[model samples]
Target: MATFSSKTFNSALYLSFRPGYNADFYKMLYDYHMRNNGQFDTAVDVGTGTGQVACVLAEKFKHVHGVDASAIMLASAVQKPNIKYHVSNGEDLNMIPSSSVDVLTVAQALHWFDHPRLFSEVKRVLKPHGTFAAVGYSFVMLENHPRASKRVYCLGNEPDQLGTFWDNGRLIVQNLYRSIEVPLKNVERHYFPDESGSELPLMMENVTMNHFRNHIKTWSSYKNYSEKHPDRPDIVDKTVDAILEEENLKEEDEVTLIWPTVLILAENNA
Candidate 1:
């Protein structure tokens, strides 16, 4: 399998671990696209993980380009019609012609990008006045189940750093957007409705453990961590099994599970 670097993990990870985006999620995305563009036109889904966001872009935009550095990620996306899914690193976006896209978007994968390089490349690919949108969502343990929250935090990943460090608002700000590391001097973020419809949609919307696992598995950090610390699989499995024993497991039949997300949209000045 051809591996795409620049990302923490390769493409098979994209396919296996990434979560899905829900209908309300896509509707808001498309609505924002409409609001941003005055109409839904063409879009490029960057870091196209498992074609989850790609499928959403395809629904609204007539021309949807799904670009990734990984052949493994792109291969799975080719079957989708009216969409051009290609392999191109996020930093080196020369494969896409200048000013070709009406909107450029990413989902859970934005934090992994090299900030300066990604913002620059995004400027190059987007047409003058084109939109760049990104969003991410994760669980707030205390809201869903206090017991499971306490159990997972006490026994979950990095217990020592869990409570104060890994709290809800901070996680989304730091991990999802990389807000502090890379300030947006050239761009200003336009607010979009998250699944929760909260003023700051980045907050948790009653997410459960399975909801957390569904997407957490997609991240390269987790992949790298698990690879380095093989003990995690056992730990995660035991916790999940315990959850199953204690309460009914959240069930879904879709091959790719989706999440409600936080989206950021920015447009270059005309």
Candidate 2:
């Protein structure tokens, strides 16, 4: 598991800056699960960072439980009547009853988990024919501006310090979780659907350069970089300024950011 134990990592920023799954994505998951399992009573979202995905699950399921290893992140999660947040490791979810979960979801978080152990726990908690969905997001994109998009890409891929700061599990996400061993039955893989019912790129609108910077600040690699390279303190700021200057964008200018996600769905044989 990727530990967010470093003091430099801010859970609040993460919660505020990170994008949430849209209504279309949530509806698609529930529809798919019901089509196969014929029920949508309970769901468990593992590695539910700040309960973003859990909140979406709560809309369809009678009961929703979100589990995360970081207490600080859980502390800031929004509370919902049908959703209950808990501090638990993905590998061992003792808090959730065995064979009680109807569906299991890992939204943009599976890469950080111990895949084999997490899968074992999923099999244990899921009822017969239960569904497991592991979702991964690809690189962020900027619309109508290739330069700005490339800058975002460079920010993510460049900076040699990030290569070391990022956990090994990130490599799995970069590979679209294709190499992760998922021991389950009836596995299926696809891209998430947009609101238009087509598999389009996940997009967010009215974003600004400052908004992008804030989101970037929430990255684990950037946090680690700030801690280790105190001398090069202005690295993040300089990068953001350069992107804004290059794009000739004001701080409040609106831009579109798109994130493409991959979904891996499997069924519990038990």
Candidate 3:
């Protein structure tokens, strides 16, 4: 989390490589909220890196706020008439008025939060029966290429690689936020590509190898490893090269990348 706050962090690269939630995903979220009598007057997106989620919420909510502890990240947020950006952590949302938010979201960020404090804040700011959604995606798998997928997985799991560089919060994300307990009521968990064979439209198809490499470069673990081993050949480049060799492909060749995604939703019934 602190890696993203660093001034040296590449916010542009992060925004460019990170996939945004599609309309169907947002429709499902809004439908759940509406079915539970949730309002749409105001929404807040905590830990809103680059304001991607907030920008989408702005289209439906009358007022939307994108909050993050990183000023450098907020600087790159998309500007919209109905959206505002704030520099604050999820645990302390004192700037937002109590019981004023209709829906609160934390995308790819809930794992880094102090859960108790953040949940307390969520209850304080969300209206009665308001929605609280937490969304994140786990490891990316190369479709139809098991060897390349394993290489990508090992890059972040093998101790000699970027494994040790990741923050402890990453484990929670990898587990699909199963350990997280939202104090709100009517809690539900949904997964893309569930075990029962259900699938969501989250996969990236025909993506250039270079684009995929750039995505790996945006990882915090990769950044940490590069800083510590400045003299070593770039691990990202090496990993991409190894992947290409394993699959007999060129950088311009297109491949499919699938990310196992999770969305947990609850209502602030309290």
RMSD of each: 5.9, 2.6, 1.2
Tell me, by lDDT, which candidate is best: 3
Candidate 3 residue-wise lDDT at 114: 96
TM-score of each: 0.69, 0.92, 0.97
Show model 1 residue runs off by greater than 4 Å. Answer: 1-17, 36-39, 139-143, 150-175, 178-222, 229-233, 245-261
TM-score of 2: 0.92
Distance (Å) between predicted and true CA of 188, model 1?
6.9
Q: Show the colliding residue pairs in model 1.
A: 20-257, 20-258, 134-264, 135-262
Sliding window of 10 residues with minimal summed lDDT for model 2: 1-10
Please provide, for model 3 over 210-266, each residue's C-alpha lDDT reduced to its tens digit, 9 standing for 90 to 100.
999999999999989888899999998999998898889999999988888888889
lDDT per residue, candidate 2, 1-270, as tens digits? 344644445788888888776666666666778778447899999988788888877888899999988887887787899998888888989998899999999988888877788888999999988989888876677778888777766766775636566765777887778788789988887764355666776435457777877887877777777777888865667777887888888888878877767778888989
Q: Show model 3 residue runs off by greater than 4 Å.
A: 201-205
Q: Tens-digit lDDT track for model 1 on 1-270?
A: 122343444555556544455565565555655665544667888888557777767777788888777765666553568788777777877768887788888776675567789888888877776777777654324334456565555543464323332223335433445462333323434333334555433333334455555444544344444555675454455655675556555633112222234566566554
- Pick by TM-score: which candidate is best? 3
The positional error of residue 259 in candidate 3, measured at the CA in angstroms, is: 0.8
Where in model 2 is the C-alpha error above 4 Å? 1-3, 159-161, 192-198
